[model samples]
Target: MSEVEKRYLAAKERYAKIGVDTDEALKKLQEVKISMHCWQGDDVKGFLNPDGELTGGIMATGNYPGAAHTPEQLRSDLEKAFAMIPGKHKVNLHAIYVDTDEKVDLNTIEPKHFSKWVDWAKEQGLGLDFNPTFFSHPMFKDNYTLASPDKEVRDFWIEHGKRSRKIAEYFGKELGQTCINNFWMPDGMKDNPIDRLSPRKRLMEALDEIFEEKLDENYTQEAVESKLFGLGAEAYTVGSHEFYMGYGLTRDKLICLDAGHFHPTEFISNKLSSLALFSKGVMLHVSRPVRWDSDHVVLMDDELTEIGRELVRNDLLPITNIGLDFFDATINRIAAWVVGTRNTQKALLKAFLEPTDDLKKIELENDFTTRMVLTEELKDFPFGDIWNQFCELNGVPVGLDWLKEVREYEKNVLLNR
Candidate 1:
């Protein structure tokens, strides 16, 4: 047997001793899902590089006009591109606006065309996801936090949500797909901090409206069975602003934690477990951090690998969706997707395979003592070995030599001390 197979066997034995079946464990490990946000002009060939190396294309952000064609033509092109992405990767269609103003609009495509697009996506064997941004419309310049002190800006934000909610409702009703409303507010402090809490409240209120309107109310004929139900919104927000909105509104809305969005000061694994504890489904956007910026780079950093693994092992929640949020102009978007997807899978596999029921138990306890124990126990774990094992499991042909090169590059840039 190969060295990796031998190590996996030993690890399997250790897990079996702890009463965990390795085959079942491996199946759980494989269940992790990875997805990406689709841009306006995604070049399929560019994303899936001919060379084995997971590097292709560049990252550019901003309003690019849809290809000069009818909605039907664009839909056709997108269908073809969707088919090219490997079956394993999930594609998130970016903002579909309603009006010419790029800021806030529902999908501009006609209702029939919109339904056709969703049907096409289903036909292509792909899942759908979305990130709601304020920049799509001209009016949302100040931002989407509805209670902004500036009356005009606040109104604009509210109006934006009202319209966006309608669009989300259409999709929910027609497509039978739940919109993962990823709300990332660009309205942070400038010089003096802004009292923008009210805007956020208004946004949530708007979402509650959408949820109420879209859900179905059931009435039973048997004597007395009356029920009113509303379509639910998967309200995913970042940890940075967790304090602004308490658990009440957020509790109902699914809380998704982005590994890169947390400040360096926060404990990510604990935060993830906390979200899981709420019994709200967990969605992850995995990326390496670079100081304050959400680098969206694939999982090459060792510290993040360790934290990500702990989240998986402790929570007992399957990674419902994994997304790569990287932006580099040179790398093909699809190639970036591949690297990010595989790297995340690697990190997850390593965590899934860790041989310690004690560690899992401690995480479940969610107390200070267990936290301290995990902090100390995982301090000296070999992160790179996990990365290597993941590569082995996935049949990644890249060898240790490439990793060594990356290490050397990191040493030159980050070490120097």
Candidate 2:
């Protein structure tokens, strides 16, 4: 047998002794598809206006050459990233990524503009998710959208939100998978506002107006995202966690919990179970935040492992939509995509390999000593062997072997750009 098979067989036997099935874990992990963000390929500079400066507290550091400049380039880069990433996955697109030659602003974008994306997705056997471009626009003046004091501004964004849902619906209908349309805008103030209620109320009303037309849930699901603060708007954000949580629960919408949008001490993993109680579903934006909302590439750190464990142990995978949300232009963008996505999959695999039933049984029986020992001991198990086997099974390069491929692509393709 091959080295991967031998290692996998030995690891399987070890896991079986603890009431865990390596095969079953791998099978389940295969079914979990993460929606990889497209912004990373081009540093959030979508095709709508490539020259437009990033605003609303958004920034991508580094002068990494060869960022995709057109729809074709972005899609090609995505194809390269997907080839290295194990398992089938979806591509997350912002409305700003619309592919068209026509002069159409965000206010007038339609599904036809994204037809190329739909065709590409069909050919690649991938799904598509979407988000409205509520930032880095001329309309985002004074750091407000959907909550702006100007009716013209709010109406324009509301129209964009409406069109975004239609585009998401089109994706789901064409690809045969539900598309999550998440709405997040940098709408807040730099200093303390005496009255936060007015803007929030306006935002609530504007969102209600946007959702006035109901779409098929089978084709599309809408999610509202919140942020603690932004660069220009640090004192108060209109869509606070509580605001969206309450709005989502009342309006029957999926709440998007971004990992980097919370406080330093706050963990999205801790919030999933609680929200699952009342909300029908949730959308996750997995990212790493150095301090504040720095939007660093995701690491296989404690928080990520905890997030994976919560999803696996509590059976929240069925009700959760997973997507990555980070833009790091410092390194090879394709490598960033591969590393972040594979780490996420690895975290999930690690969770699936856990003997959760046994641990829970021990905990329920008040066997804290055994529970603690087993949990810690499982950490030292042969997880890397299992991961390598998974990569081998999925027909992707195993371990650091994928990095070599990425570097080769960089040398041949990226350098030329």
Candidate 3:
């Protein structure tokens, strides 16, 4: 037998001895569908206007050459990124990425504005997710949208939210899969506000208006995301975690938990079980944080592994909506996508390799000492071998071979621009 076949057999025996079906684990891992963010390729600039500079708190650092400048280029770059990524996936888009002949006001945007995206996704056999762009416009210069005290501003953003939902419905109908429409606004004060309650009250009123006209839930899922702070919004975020969590539970909406948006010591793994208790599904934006809400590319770290473990052990994969939300312009954009996405899969696979059934039984029996030792010992198993077999089965490059492939793309395609 070949080397890969032999290694997989050996690893399979080891996993089987621990009560894990290696083949079943690999199959389940393949069933995971992660939505890759399109903003990463273009650094969140989208195609709103060629001259539109980065606004809001989100900014991708570095003068990386050949960042996508147009819709066609962005889609082309995504094709390359998707090729190296192992699993079939969806591409996340902000409304600003709409392909149109002229600047379309946010409130007036139609599904026609995104027809090209739908056509492309159909052609590529991928699904699409959407976000309402609440920043970078002149109206939001005060750092407010839905939560603004001004009635005119709130009404305009409410219309935009409605339009975004319509477009998400279109995506779902056209692609035959539900599209997740996420809404996040950068509304807060630089310093302590004298009237925080008023803004939040206005926000609730506006949201009530936004969701008053409901679309079919099967075609469109709405997610509300909260942030602790942004560049200027240091004192308080209008849509704090508490705010969205309560809103989500009360309204039966999905709540998004961004890893980088919480306190440094807080981890999402610990929150999964609690989240699963209420919401039908939770939206996860997997990004690494370095001290603050700095959306760094995700790595295969302990916290990430634990997040994966929680999902698998709790049987929450069916209810966990996973997506990547980091943009690092300093490196080759394609490589960043590959590394972040592949590392996420690696974490999930590591979780799959664990003998969770056995570990949990031991824990229930109150044999804490043995449980701890087995947990630690399982880490040194031939996980790498199993991972290599997974890549082989999926028809992707094994180990570090993809590094050379991405370098070639950078030289021939990325630097050409």
TM-scores of all candidate predictions against the true structure: 0.62, 0.99, 0.98
lDDT of 2: 0.94
What residue pairs are clashing in model 2? none
Where is the poorest 10-residue window by lDDT in model 1?
219-228
> Any runs in candidate 3 off by more than 4 Å, and if so which?
none
Higher-TM-score candidate among 1 and 2?
A: 2
Top TM-score prediction, candidate number: 2
Candidate 3's TM-score: 0.98
Off by over 4 Å in 1: 1-22, 40-89, 96-113, 143-145, 149-179, 194-240, 243-251, 318-321, 358-417
Q: Tell me the tens digit of each residue's lDDT in model 1 across 108-183.
A: 3233424544665567655555544443344434323443446676555545444444444455555454545454
lDDT of 3 by residue, 316-371 (tens): 88887888999999888988888899888988998888888888889999999999
Error (Å) of candidate 1 at residue 42 is: 5.3
Residue pairs clashing in model 3 are: none
Ranking by lDDT: 2, 3, 1
lDDT of 1 at 75: 46
